[model samples]
Structures are given as structure tokens and as C-alpha cells.
Target chain A: MATTTVSPPAPGAAVPGRRRRTPLARREARWAWLFLAPWIVGFLAFQAGPMIASAWLSLTEYDVINPPEYTGLDNYRELMADPQVARSLGNTVYYTALHVPLVMLISLGLALLLKRVGRLQGFFRTVFYLPVMTPAVAVGILFLLLLNTQDGLINRGLALVGIDGPSWTTDPDWVMPGIVLMSLWSLGSTVIIYLAALQNVPRDLYEAASIDGAGAWARFRHVTLPMISGALFFTLVVNTIASLQMFTEVYTMYFGNRQTQTSFNSDAATFYVIHLFQEAFQFLHMGYASAMAWLLFLIIMGITLVQVKLSKRFVYYEGEDQ
Target chain B: MLFVAALVGAAVIFMLPFVWLISASLRPREYVFAPGFLPVPFAPENYAEAWRAVPLVTWLLNSLVVGVAAAAAVTLSSAWVAFGFAYFRFPGRNLLFGLVLATMMLPFAVTMIPTYLIWSELRLTDTQVPLWAGNLFGSAFYIFLLRQFLLSLPREYFEAARMDGASYPQLFWKLAFPLIRPALLVAFVFEFKASWTDLLKPLIYLRDEHLYTLPRGLKVVLDRFGYGGEQQWEVVLAGSVISTVPMIILFFLAQRHFIEGIATGGRKG
Candidate 1:
């Protein structure tokens, strides 16, 4: 109110008059800048400078022990030709392929069950979602103990059923699968997301399908699936991105046991990010690591763009002008 | 119905690791190898041994400090930034907000090297500053989350404050903040979980043993004791159980707010 009285615009003043506008505009800008100072400084010191430096560092062959030398395109070319990169990429793709679908299925099941339950839904939902709160590192260790070869509880349980469980981590064939199984521990968050989406689904659609003599599976297919496809697609995009960056489980499982010298069998579990980490810090190949980071950026960007493009065909929006 | 049975079955299977963790933690040294769901003669002392094995109390204190500090920093700064974007008109506002969100796409791998370089140059590698420094900038996720909440609030509140001669800071403190306390609390829980569970930053930054957080300390315990002998397994399991306890407790305490936060945050997406 004081500001309104102190600063009044003349009715006859020219629109965009420099005298009247500049000071007020400047005042607004100052306030905005004051509000934005922290984020901007952080972005510059932590984000922009680092991003540009990493981009430049990608072209130079710099180990920490020696000065960087310009080796234009060599890192890129080597990355193109490297079998290890190819192997890691292949392993990552395989891991994502297996893991994402399983995650979607399990989370969808949880969400649907919670939605259908008439009583104590809150209790069940909370119980099922506890894994999201568990520390991921601890979960990795717990899985390691459970999947260990000799005294593992998983093997013991299987033995009682007249089946023998393979060494989950050391065996090359089982390594990625073990990672996938371990990954299910954190499905709580995804289930929570799906549950939220399911809650938003219109009740009438299910009732309509029921009136048409639809069975549970038929109703789910005709009503539930179509209704939640937007959430489904959103989850897929986020999940794909998250799964592509899966490093913690592998690092903990493999590196945590590095003293044992238990060969990961085929490097099948060495994901792309893990390999990039090795090159950057462990091997001190900053330039090569930069190139690897850029390549991953491009790969993730490409996948995300493809998903965005493909979303139009599958994702349904309710009551939109379209 | 078969569906109920199937869901129950799946829930039990899903909860196996948690059950095993508690079981293994409670089992006596002799009964560890004896395969069963129940532990005979519960060794509650394992929790004590686990406590003494590492400076877990110190780790807990460190974790609480980092978590609370990060949560406070993120909520305050993000709410301030969100208020500006939601309430005020300014030049380059949209561009700046978009830039803020765009940075989210830049993964840590791209920034880790340069960040480490800057921190090492500043001689902050051995302190908790590196962990908390990232929070000062306002993470993209929290910023976006708060912005959505702030945007949905009635604009009349800000306009009324302006009519009452309130400056931006006063409006933020007295009016906008109280209304958005729920959102701020939700962001607190998120930021807390992120800081608490974070392993990589602390592993990279803190060099001294006493400075180690829970996850990093768990790694040390796992390496030192999880192997070499059968008795060590009990200690490690007990340690793992100890490390996981606070999170379980925190989840129970904050579960309602957390779920609501997730639901609300998810709705906009």
C-alpha cells in the first residue's frame, strides 16, 4: 500500500516511457537477482563450468599425473572401436530390457491390488512401500548375503525344494539376473507412483466394464490399462532413464567384494556408468571419461526423445481438446 | 479369491530380505548357520556389539546433521526461488526457470570431475561441506516440486500482502510460508532421505575414519568383518541391521506425509 502511494503512473505518460520504466524495471531485476543469487552461483561453480570443462577435457588426453595434451577425436574414435564399451553397453541394454518390464509388472500389480482392496488398504500400501525407505547400500549388502553361494539363505531355501541355486554374483550367467532380482527391492517407490496413478483412474470406467459382463482381466485390459497409460508412459520414461544409470547395485555387489577376487566372470555386470567411473577416477583418463559421459548423454537423450515421440500413440489424456 | 492369495504370496516374497535381515541380526553365533525363519535364543547383544564395532553413534549424529542441514537448506532456498518465479514478473524469468529444470538432465557423471577439481582446489575434500554444498544451489527436483506447489496457491495472498506494504521477503516469511508449510515439510522428508542414503559423495569427500557417514561406515565394516570367519558374519549382519534401523523408524514416523507428498508430486507429472 505504501509502494502503491509512493509510485504512481501518470495517465498521460507515454507507454514504455524510459523515465518511469527503467527504475522500476531495475528494481524488479535487482530483487529477482537477489533471489536467484545462490542457484546461479552454484550453477556456475558446480554445473556450467564443470560441464564446459568436461566437454573440453573430452578432447584432450589428460591423466592426473601429467598435463593434458590435445588429442582431438582420438578418445571418441577409441570409444567407437572399443569392445569393452560395446560389451558394457550391451550388458546395460540387456539389464534394462529385463528389469524395466519386471518392475512395471510388479508395481502395477501392487497398485491394482491396493486399489481393489476395500479395507485396510492404507496398511497394505504402507507395508508394501517400506522398501523405498530402506537404504539402497544396505539392501545391496543384504542381497549379497542372501545370494551368496555357500551359506546363502536363497540357496538353502532352494535346496529344501529339491532345487540347487547357482552362485548369483560370481557366475557370469547369473550376475545380471542377480542384479535384476536385487533391483526389485526398491520397487516400493515405483509401486507408490503407480498407486497414485491408479487412484486417479475414474471409477465409472470399471463400473461400466463390469456392467458389460467383463471379467477382471478383461476389465483391467479394457478399462485400467487404457486409463493409466499416461502414468505408465511417464513411469517408463523415468524408469528407463533411472535403469540406464544403474551403478550402485553393481558397484556394491562387485566392488564391495573386490578383496575376494571373485571374478565377475564375464564383465557382464560392468555397466556403462560403472565403466565410465573406472575410466575417469580409477584409471585417471579424464578426457576419455568425458567422451564416455557425452556418449551416455547422447544415448539417454536419444532414448528419451524416442519415448516422447512414441508416447503419442499410447498415452491417453482425459478430456483434452485433442 | 486367488488374487488375494497371490498378492499375499507376492508380499511375503517381497519382504524376505527384511525378514532375513532381522533374523540374521538376532541369531546367536552358533545358530547363524542353522537354517530357519526363527532364531533360537535371541542374541540381543549383537546389536550392542554392532554399536561398539563402529562409532555408529557418531555416524548417526553425522547423518542426522547432514540430513537436517540439507533438508533445511533445500526447503528454504527452493521455497524462496519458487516464490520469485510464481509471484513476481521479471525479465528472463521463464528462461531462468527452464534453465533450472534443464540442469536436471545433466547427470552427476558429467559434473563429478569438475566438481571434485573445484573442491580439491578449495581444500574441502575432507569436510562435510562438499555434501552440503550441493544443497545450497537448490536441486532441480526440489525446485520444480516447490514451484508447482507455489503456483497452485491463490495469487490473492501475494497481492493482499503487497497491498499491506509487504516486501517480497516479508510476504515470503509471514504469508506465503505458513500456507506452504506442508509442502516444505514434504520437501524436508525428500531431502532428508536423499542425504541420509547418499553414499557416493561422502565416500569421495570424507577421508578420515571419524568423518565417515553410515553407508561409508557400513562399507568399512563389511570389508573388515563380513568376511574371514563365520563369527564375522554375525557382526556384519548386526551392523547392517543397525544401519538400516533409523531409516525404518523414520519411514514409520513420516510415512503418511511421505506418501501424500509422492501422490501430490506425482499428480502434476
Candidate 2:
């Protein structure tokens, strides 16, 4: 876990002189740019250029086939009026709300359990992570089978305990929950993160807490939680962002060319990105879609900023100045 | 004792979908949803049927090529950029690196359509190039990962190589590259898995059925064979298993690297 075996000076450690550079230093700088040329080129082409184009396109109505016409914020106005936009955004927020906390809790619980395992840690970790490695499309299809109303394994399992399972795929009320269940299968990475953080917590702290006559719960609350809060916060933000963009799994299960299966409550799973995809690709409303994308980008940025601000109060980073 | 029992129970629950998938894949059409874990009336013909029903092999091959191209492109390029960040002391370097990391926070939704337009403008849409070509520049996350590894290496090696009159490329190719093979492999396998599982890019860029990757092909398979068309649950499960086995195998082989990479990522955060 201690990866930096021989730590060198930090990447941007201050050089001796501030005003001037040696010839050798200048030569090294030239070589650095040369080394970074590919990424620079890519940043311009794929990221920066596309971002500017997306912003400009958001203000203009230009389908791929049509000449550009300035829309003057009409797309944004329509977005505010569009019921599907609101519905999709609501669905995304709902999914994120349920998915993020559940994932963090389950993953943290699994990590705690793994920390207790003695010899078979690797074996259990592999089993837990196997589902994470499965392709989302495959997960979607597998879950569709598992969550079948009548004969799915999930319902069959529930029957054993005399609890009738809801029709997960077909019922509108249960569709998002089904997606959340599918999402839980891939919490293995989060679990591993928490485990790493848990292992990194100094053992002496727990011992000291016990010696101070603290119980297990107090020891965990006072010693464990604060020590691992950094990792917990990291997963919280990452999982929230990912959950907000839920797409491939939902699309594969409910919407993608499955005309026959469209009778189900597919609208319940129409996430924001899915709606944006339909607007851009399906309906050729590229301008409107770009507006939607910018909206999502703002929402994500705002949420992330809020999370980072909140983390300052909660997350404990060792060796940092208060 | 209770903890271990609970862990085993949770693991079983976590593994239930996979177990049911394999079992359903092996069952006859009539028993596709049988309650028991075992495939009582075993039937392996579902694999054969799934293969015949769609171009599963072609999709698998396309995925392999795309995955390899993407992995190689991103791994090399990100490593090169990371080496620059790690080894050099240049003005504006920190600002540039910060810019690279900022790109990670930009959701793909914002850039998806515009990037598609860029590809289409280049007249490269509907080909496999759009899928892997973007990786030629490199990814921010991989660049960050490899940079951490590069930063940890002893600088004396590079300085000594420089003193011996080795050119920067020679130093990187002959020394830095070999030293950071572990991190590079981690980057490669991670990108490969990403490309293999990627459905959106293929769905957006590729229109031809013959050019489909596994995930994209599986989507179509779901439509034509699964709940959408024939309701052939066994056949669909067989396809799911086929698409998943390679990744499972990859995980088992590179299990250590995968876990280590994730752990390092957490620490970095």
C-alpha cells in the first residue's frame, strides 16, 4: 500500500533561483513540451475545441443537415418548458439520491467485513469484484432476466421467504429500484477503496481508544470514521457523479431498439443523458441537446463544488495544517 | 464467526446473478427460469444458437481490435505526458497539468455531440477509428495515474542517463519505460476493459451491424433474441456469459494490478 518507496522531490518543487533559468534547465523545459505534445494536441482537438463548439452550438439551431441559424436562447427556454427535461432531471436526481448513499453504505460495510477476514481476503475480494468487471450491457441483460416479474430468480428467492417481489422491470414504481439493485452489483471498487483506507488507519489509535475505556462503537466513531473519512468523501463524490450519468445499463435494459419491450414503464428510467441522447441523435435537435448538456455540466460542477466545500468540514487528511 | 458467516452469505448474494446466468445459459429453453441452481436439463446448444443468431465472433474480434488499439494508444501517450510532468522542472508546467486534470471533471455529455461532429467532420464516423482514435491524445485519469508512478521513481537514474549523453527519448524508451512497466500494464488493462465494455461510442459512431462491438452487438442481440423479439432467454444469457468471460479471465490474471491500481487511486484522492 505504501507505493512511494523512494520519494523524490515533488514534481513542482521550487528551483533555487526564481528570476532566471540555466541553459540545461531551459533545454529540459523544451524537451518537456515535446514529450507533452500528444496530450496538448488531444486536449485542443477533443476537449477544448469540442467544449467551445458545444457552447456555441448551444446558442444556435443547427442540425447536422441544416445550415446554422441563431436561436437566441430559445433552446434553453424550450428546455425549461419541456416536461421530459424536468422528468428526466427528476429521475436522474432520484437515481443519484438512492444509488450514491446505498453504494457507499454497502461498499463500506463490505470493506469492514473484508477487513475482518483472516486468510481468504484475496478470495473474497475477487468474488466481490467479479461483478464489477462484467460489462454494463451484460449486467443489464442479466438483471432483466433476474428481475422478471413472474419467474426471475430474484422473485423466486423472495418466494422462499414468503415475500412476493414486485415486478421490477415492468412496474413503473419499481423500475428505478431495479436499476439501483443492478448498480449495487458493481460497488466492489468502492469497497476496495474503503478497505485500503481502513487498512491505512493506524492501529495504535484503536488500541488507545480501547485503553481509554471506549467501547467498539466509540472506537469506530472516534478513531476509524475520521481516519477513513477522506476515502469515504472521495467515493461519495465519485459515485454521485457516476450515478448522475446513468445510461448504458438503463438504455440496454429498457429503451434500446427493444420495441416489443417498450410496453414496460420505460419513462421511469429516462435519465437526463438518455433524454439528451434522444434529442441529439434520435430527433436531430443538436442545439437543444447541447443546451441540455451545458445544463448537466453546470449541475455537476455545482454539486461537485458543494461536495468539496462540505468535505473540508468532515474529511480528515493526516499531516495537513488546520 | 458471525462475521465470516455473514461475509460468505453476502458473497453468495453478490454472486447470485452470475450463478443464475451460467445456470440459465446451460438450461434447455423450457427450463430457463427453473428455481434450482443446477441446470437439471442441461443444454449447451444455447451457445451455438447465440453464435448463429448474431455475429458474436465478429463483434468479439472488433472489440479486441478496438480495445487493443485504445489501450496501446492511451498507455503510451499518457505515459509519455506523465514522464514529462514527473521528470521536468518547467514554468507553467503545474498550470498545464492542472488543466489536464480539470478535463476529467467535464462530463462526456457536454462534449459527446460536438466530438461526434468533429469525427463526422473528418469523415471518420461509422468506422472503428472514432472509437479508439481519441485515445491517441491520452486520458487525464491515466496520465494522472502514470504520473504518480513516474514521480515515485528515483531521479538519479534519469539524471545519470542524462549525464551519459542519452537523449530524452532514449532515456524514456530505454530507462523510464522499463522501470514503470507495472504502472503501464495497469493503465493498459484498465483501458482495454473500458473499451471492451464501452457501448455508447459504438452505438453512436457505428451504424453497420458488421462493425459492432460486443456490447453494441449484445444490445441488438437483446432486441432480436431476448425479451424484445423471440424471448429466447437461454440464448441471451449465453451471449451475456460469452461477453463476460473474457473480462472475468482478465480480472483473474491481473487481479493484483487491478486491486493495486484502485487502492492507489483511493489514496490519491
Candidate 3:
């Protein structure tokens, strides 16, 4: 169905406006509100209220112990001047740029392979998805072992091919790539998503295209790609947003316990959320961190909006009037 | 034949890290970095050592408690809310549902600090309460998921129940709840996984080592054994495997639901 999207549909679809209210409808409305009470309370306490608080906190200099002092626009201005902010944002963007496309491509490829597999489809899917089940902490630790410069499995594998591998965790240049490699292990979920979408593509379309003398690649490009473009666009946006907020894995591996490490290039791995986390928790720069959070919120919103705008051109919904 | 070969090859690559993890966990401290895939000098004592080196059992128990609490809370509440949106054709329902969907996109970073502050203000920071308590309000994603499932159910069933003079609560607890068990289970399992693998919340709120969940405890284990103290990589790998086993078991047990739920997610996307 065209409605098979993970992203929420546009807000006002098929909504009846200003209908004459029956007594039964009013009763149902009251009951609906009652049923929604818990969420409303939660939304107020956890989300909406906190968002307002965070916005105000961004304009103050509170460090939990002291009373918040007013400093309008100061934190925002500091964010503009902060070099670490720039570095962290750049690192996050770089990582996202590297990660999103690579993951989409690899997962799509795996999904295609899985689709071609006969009886062993489920078996292969399970094998691929096992890593996705692993906790971020475990994944991070496991990757540290795998990416070790000297005796790690990955480097050893490279050595088997007569190619020297860089010290993934230690070297500045290779650190982000190492994290990206680690992230790629968990692309199974994406693969599963693509597989589901791929399976949903009508066989008749492919048959028709083939009947028109279209080759395999041409059939795929014409029939399969457009049919699954909604899913692709969805994953692209979701993965990009998730990549921007890459914290737990990077933190666990590189920046979590820096006091223990003598020499690891953590700078390359210092993503934006990591920097915000450090400020809020480590340095207790509550005001500054709040500003960073708002900035990230704005960036994510802007990007998602741009994606939705762009998807109008690329994503084909079935049965939509062209 | 070539396609099968290609699938097998890719599957091997995908499975290699796990194979190596299992092998490394079973190896001696000195042999952890060994090149061979087989644990020739088999050292199952690493599990014992890892168990002793960290409060692995306690962390697992803590993880179970938090995961269950979070999962149960989110599942029940989200289902309740979803039922409201699904069964009730009320004014402003679409608007409210739209708002719920919008919250799914709001990054957790915006609320992280203030939410922490809210807990600390209530003097509930450092307790396990902060880990799962907020879930009592129902999460946006689960609400949407359950709502979709609820929407797919035939309205005739609910109407039939209502015509039998069933109250709203009866309509929910007796009719909708039982009918939506599959969706509820999906939401529960998904949330359980999320809570089990969550590191950030525990890292922020938890101070006492005894209170740490598996992921947070694993982080401590990594710091102690893997990086700092003794640099015993085997012990860390063993702990990692220990922490991962529950999830792997859950996956196998709920394989159908897990696959179906994910596919549903893909379909919805």
C-alpha cells in the first residue's frame, strides 16, 4: 500500500473539519481525552515543558548548583565562536556524509542478495541481523578489539591480502572510518527494511518491463527503484538524523573513559552530540549545552524539511495523480 | 549457483565478527589477539573471570528489571492511546494524533538535559526510576505502531462489543487489548531491546555501580578490564558476549514477530 511509510503522513489528510457535533461524538471525544491523559501528562512533563525550559536554559548560566543568571543570546553567540563546536559539528557531518550512503548501498545490496536466495532467505537475514541485536556498548567494545592496530581481526584480514592497515582506533585519519566500519555492522535493520520494500514491488511491473525488451539492470532501474524510493528516502533521512546523533558507540569506544587512555585520537570521533553531552554532563555548561541542543534541533528540522521537499521529486507514491 | 555462492560469501562476512567475538571470548588472555578463528587453547574460564571481574549477574538482573519496566509501561500506555485514536471517531483526534507523530522526530538531545534536571529535582537521579519511569507516558513511536495495527482491525468487532453494552474500559481491556496482542507484543519486544541496549540514559542518571544496567555495566567493565586495569581484552569480550546472549536468545524466540514488526516498520516507511 502507498501508506506503508515509517514517516508520519501529512497532518491533515481526510480530516473532517468543523463537523456538527452529536452528543455521542462529544462523549467519545471526552473519552478520547481521558484515554490520552497519560500521554498528555508525559508530553507536558517530559517533552513540551522541557523544550521550553531548555530554550530558557540556553539563555542562562545555570550549573545545577547555582541559580540561573540571565544572559540573553550569549550562549548562542558563544556557540558561533566555539572552535570545538565547529569541529564537532564538522566531524558529525563528515561521519554522516560517509555513513549514510555507504550503509544504504550495502544494505540495499544485501537485501537484493537475500531476495534472490531461495530457501535460505530467512537464514541469511538472521545472520545479518544478529549484529543489529547487539547492544551499542558491546558493539563498541567488540569493534575496539576488531580494529586494534596490531592484532585485530580486521587488520589481520588486511594483512592476509598483503595490505597494511592503519591503527584504526589510534590514528586520527582512520578513526572516523573505523567508527563508520563499526556502524556498518548494524546495517542489518536497514537491509531488512529494504528487503521488505523490495518484496512488495509488483512482479507484473518487472514482467512488463522485461517484455518491453528491458534488460535486468534496466528493469531494476525502471521498476524496482521507483517502487521502493519511498523506503529509500525514508531510510536516508532516518539514517542521516541517527548518524548526526551518534553518541553511545563513539563515547563507549573513544571518549567514554579518556582518563584511562594515554594516546588515542578522540578528536576525529568527537561528534556534535558527544560534545553537547560533554558540556552538559562533564563541564556542567548547562546553558551552552542547551544552546547546542537547540542548534541541533534546528539543523535536524531544516534537513528533514529539505529532504521532504526533495522527496517530492524522487519518491513515487502508487496511485497518486501525476 | 553464482547467486548462492555470493549469498554464502556475504553471509560469512556478516557472521565473521560474531564468530570472532565468540572465539575471542573463549580464548586465554594472551591468546585473545590470536589470528586463528578457532579457540585452540580453549579458555572458557574467561567467562568465569569476566563474571568475577564485574557484577555480571547483578547487571543482567538490573537490565531485566529496567527493560521489562520500560517495555511494559510503553506497550500498555501506547496501546491505550492508540486505541483511543483508533476506536474513537472524535473531534480533534487527527490533530492530536498528528502531534504524537511529530514528537517522534524531535531529537532526544533537546530533552536530555532538562529531563535529567527534572529527575534530579525530584531527587530521583541515580535511582533506577529515571531509567524507565518516563515510559509510563507512552512513547511516540510505539503509539504510532499500535495505532496502525489498531486501524487495520475490523471496526465491526469493536462495534459488536459496544452493542453488547460494554463500557469504554471494557471495550478496551476486554475487546481491543486482546485483539491487539500481536501489536502489543511487537511494541514490548522493541522497547525491551531499546531499553536493554540504551547506554546514554544510564550513563547520565546512574552513579552507583550496583545500579548499572548491562550496557552501562559493560562500559565500566570495558574501562576496568579492556582499557585501564590489566588490559584484559578477553575478560571484556566475555562480558560483551554475556550481555549480548539475552538479546540473541530473545531474537531467536521471537524471530517471527521481530521480522514481521521490522517489515511492518519498513512498509510504514
Candidate 4:
């Protein structure tokens, strides 16, 4: 050991003899920062640089072949009037509004049921998480098969039970709902998070609730809910953000004849990200798409802020002792 | 009795889609609309047919390359960066780590145009560079997970390593890296899955057929072969089956550590 760690300074050493920063500590800090160099560079180039560029790009009309021209918020103004933007908004909100809550309920319920199961805890966990591991594109393809109007497995099965199934993806009204169901199928990780949180809740609280003659639902509402509020809030925010960015699944699900479809279908299920993608890539409306991107960012931030504020009242954080 | 009902009910809901998918994949071409869940007169050659139809080998290889490379980059760089955050107490450490979390919320759309411009400017588009290039730097989520894992580690090793004159780099590569292998595995599997399944990146960057990854290849296959009278789904389902089965096996194998990673991530404020 070189002991090159010793610094030149004892000048700050007082009657209490507070130590100065050692060479080794200084070297460690330097090394730490060095280790983070790749990330620092990446964050600047990929994240911060693009963010600033996007704000600027949103205000202009830039075509990839030509240089960006200063248009003074024309893209923003256009976005305000764009019918496509409106359709994208309607579609996104439709998906998120149902998808988030549905996923939450399913995930939480699965966690609760799994907790009570005498055996097969691991089996249930594995089964639930399997879909999460499946690729979104594959799920989209499977849904295209399963959600077929007549011959598909879903309708075939439904007929056995004396029920009819809708043309899920093709039907304007059912499209978003179909996508939501597909996304909901992968709530495995969310359930795992909730299950972990559920396990941490004090058993005594449940016991106390039961002793007070509260039934299962009553105990769940009062005791269980508050205990895992943090996890609930976490899932809510994450699910909302993800659902708002819905694309690959919807895009692939309807990848059939894209030239004729999304454009003519009233944009019913063309999600915000998909719409933005088509604008930027397909139509070369880079500046307009960038504007939409900024708006999406604002919307996500606003939703998160609202969730934070809302959860402040509902989410329970216990003291360190408990 | 009610608990049993709930358990079975939840299990059915969770398992049905997969069961249907697996069943459909194995069903004979003509019997695709067969009445039951089981694939009667099972067609075992669906896998072989799908393997031959598309360049499943090429796409799988591409995806594997991207997945393995991205995972390697992610595991190492994220662990390195997270090591910095977790092990060292420095000025602005908390603020910087907060920046890491904050970056996660910035959607890809916000950054896509410029980043694409950057890649295109460097002539990297229509190639695979754009997909895995940025991954080499690491992601905020994995960084946070690795940092969380590192925070729990005992500092006793640092003293002994210091006595042995080991520098921070040596300590990181030699000591901390092995100890945090579990967290690294979690990050690796995550990045691998992400890279393999990622559609948006490949969609934006790779336009060449040969360059297409599995997801993109699968999409192309669906668009082309998806039309159908017969033999269509056998191929498509086979492709889907091929795409799905590996990840499922991986999930089962690394099940515990994988859940631990997710649980660890959610546990923090």
C-alpha cells in the first residue's frame, strides 16, 4: 500500500482534529466520476441535448433534407388546430383511461389472491409474469389472431359459451379496448411489485381488523389499501405514463395495409406516439412531430404531478421504527 | 372456498392467453379453428416451417447480437455508474442521482428526432448502431436498480482492498463487480429482453431487410404471410412461438433474481 493517501494539509486540523480530505478518498471520488463518464456523456448527447433541441425544433418547421427554418411557433399553432392531434389525443386518453385502472385492479387482485393461496405461490407468480416476458410485437400478433371476428380463437371459444365477439382491431369502437386488454395481459411485474408490498404489511393490522368484525372487503378497503398505498401510487404513475406512450402493439396489430388503414379509419385507435411517428417519419413533418412530443412531455409531467398531489392524501408512509 | 375460487379464477385469467397461443401454434393448418384448447393431431413441424419461411435465423442472430451487446454494455456501464453513485458520497451525489431518475420520464418521442438526426448525420441509420449504441452508456432504471443493490453492501471489503493498495478501478472490477453480480444479472436480462423485443428503435433506424431484428422481422412476416387461407397461421404462430418460448424459459430460469430486481426497484421511494 503506497499510503499516498496522506494529504499535505493538516492546516484545517483544529483542537477537535477534524481530518482533511485524504488522497485516497479524493482518488476514489475521481475514479467514481471517471466510472460515470460514459453515462455523463450519454446523458448529455441523448437526453439533455435532444431535450433542448426538441424545444427549438418544436418552434420551427424542419424537414430532414433541408435545414430547419425559424417559423415562430407555427408548428405549435398548427398542432392546436390539427385534427390528427385531436384524434391522437382521443385515442390516447381512451386507452389510458381504461388501461391504467384495469391493470391496477387486476394486478392488485392477483397479488391478493396469490397471497392467500396455500401452495402454488411460485407457480402463480411464474404464470403471471410469463406474458410480461413475451415481446409486445408477439402479443400484438397473437391478438390479431385471437381477436379475429369469427374464426379466431377468442370468438370460437365465445361461441361455445353462447356469446358473440366483436371484430376487435377493425372495429373503431373496440380497437382501443382490445389494445388495453392486450397491454393488461402483461401486468405481471406490477403484480409482483404489489405482492412484495402486500407481504410487508403487518399481519397484526389484518388480525385487528378481522377481530373488529370487518369482512374481507372491509379489511381490504381499510387495512390493506393504506398499507400498500405507496406501491399502488407507484403502479398508477408508471402505468399511466406507459399507457400514454402506447405504440408498437397497436402499430403491429394493425400493420395490415397501413397505407389505407390508419389514415381512413378516422384515426380512432391511432395512438399519440404512432401518430407522431407517422408525422415525423412518414410525412416528414419533423417540426410538427417535435411539437407533439413536447406536448406529450407536458401532459405526462402534468399527470405525474396530479398523481403526486393526489397520493399525498391517500398514500401512507410509516415512520422508520415501524 | 372463496379463496380457492379467487386463486383458480385469477390463474385462469392469467394463463388463458398463453395457453391459447401455445395451442394455436401447435394446431395443424386445417384444424386451426378446432373446437378445443388442445392441438389435436398436433403439427410438430410448425416450428420447422416458421424457421424456414422468414430469415428467422438471421433475425434471431441480429436480435441476439444486439441483445448480448446491449446487455453487456448495460450491465457493465450501469453497474459502473451505479457503483459511483452508491459507493461514493460526493458533492451533488444526491442531485445527480435524482437527475438519473428524472431522465426516465423524458419520453423517447421528445428525443427521437434529434437523436435520429445525430445518428443519420453520422451515417449510422439503416444500420444497427442507433439501437445498441446509446445502450452502451446505460439506462436510468438499471442504474437505479444497481445503485440500490450496491447501497446495501458492506464497506468492510473497501478497508481490506485499500490495505492491499487496490485503487478504485481495481476495487470496482475485481471486488464490487463480483459481489453485485446478481444485480448485474438482473440488469443484463432486462437489457437483453429490451433490446431483443424493441420495435420502435429498429423501426426508426433499420430499413434494410437484412438488418431487421426479430421483432421487426416478425412484423414483416405478419404483414406478408398474415393474409391467409391456410398454412399462414402455422407459419405466423410458429414465428410467434419461436419468439416467445426462449424468453419464457429465461424467465423461469432466472425467476428469483428477476423478481428481486423488480421488488428492489419498487421498494425505494
Please name the candidate that would achieve the greatest DockQ relative to the true structure: 2
**lDDT (tens digit, per residue) of candidate 1 on B1-269:** 77777778777877877888888778877676567777666888888888887798888788899889898998898888877766666557788888998897787888887787788889888998888867877777777777777777766666666767787789788988888888888889888988888887876788898888888887777767765223376777887777788888888888877897777655545
Which stretch of 10 consecutive residues in model 4 chain A shows the poorest summed lDDT? A1-10
Write the candidate numbers in order of decreasing TM-score: 2, 3, 4, 1
Candidate 1 residue runs with Cα over 4 Å from true position: A1-25, A210-215, A256-258, A262-266, B228-231
Please give the range of 10 consecutive residues that has the lowest summed lDDT in model 1 chain B: B225-234
Top TM-score hit: 2
TM-score, one value per model: 0.93, 0.96, 0.95, 0.93
| Model 1, position A143: C-alpha lDDT score | 86
Model 3 alpha-carbon miss at residue B227, Å: 2.3
Q: Pick by lDDT: which candidate is best?
A: 2
Q: Candidate 2's residue-wise lDDT over B133-163, tens digit each?
A: 8998989999999998888887888877877
Q: Which 10 consecutive positions of candidate 3 chain B have the poorest summed lDDT?
A: B85-94
- For B117-208, candidate 3 gives per-residue lDDT tens digits of 99999999999999999999988888888888877777767667766878788988988899889889999899999999999999999999
RMSD of 3: 3.7
On lDDT, the stronger of 1 and 3 is: 3
The backbone clash count of each candidate, in order, is: 0, 0, 6, 0
